[model samples]
Target: MPHIIIEHSASLDTDFSQLLKSIHQSTIDTNLFDASTIKTRRVAFPQCILGDGKTDFVHVQVHLLAGRTQTQKQHLSESLLNTLRTLLSDSVSLSVHPYDLDPAIYRKN
Candidate 1:
């Protein structure tokens, strides 16, 4: 399974739900996993908490089951980042990070 967790500034007034759908579709297009197995959620922060007050940011963390090649991971990151940039305003800083989930430690029912 691949879970996409997005964190963005609460001040952002973007169409967040559409953004989530685009991300989900991008992952599905890779054909590495079934559409049913892809999950996405977004969290908005009240403040940057660790950055300059005037700066807005959108950060996406993609967690996938282990065994994907490096190329797959990079494409996943790029696809999501491109989607984010297109949907968000130029004032917002964006970033994407891909992580491997350890099957031995991850649990789902």
Candidate 2:
């Protein structure tokens, strides 16, 4: 199972619902997970400061059960990052980090 959590600055003008759909589709394009199983959500920071105080940001963290090969993980990360690059402005700080959850401890129920 994988959970896509998106964190962004509230000041940024973007449609998060569409972003979620785009990311979910990109994840499906990787052929790593079923479309029905992918979970996506977003959290906007209304009060926060970026490094330069003028930069807005969007950071995506993908958490999944640990087992995927490094190449697969890298591909997932790059694919998601590329999606962000196309949607967000150049001035926005964008990043994608894929985290492997311990399969032994991760539970959905």
User: Which residue pairs in candidate 2 have backbone atoms (N, alpha carbon, C) closer than 3 angstroms, thus clashing?
Assistant: none
Off by over 4 Å in 2: 52-54
| Candidate 1 per-residue lDDT over residues 1-109, each given as its tens digit | 8899999889888888898888888888878888998999999999775454447888999999899999988888898888888888777888999899999999999
Candidate 1: C-alpha lDDT: 0.87
TM-score of 2: 0.93
TM-score of each: 0.91, 0.93
lDDT of 2 by residue, 1-67 (tens): 5899999988889888889889888988999987788899999989777786556899999999898
Which candidate leads the pack in lDDT? 2
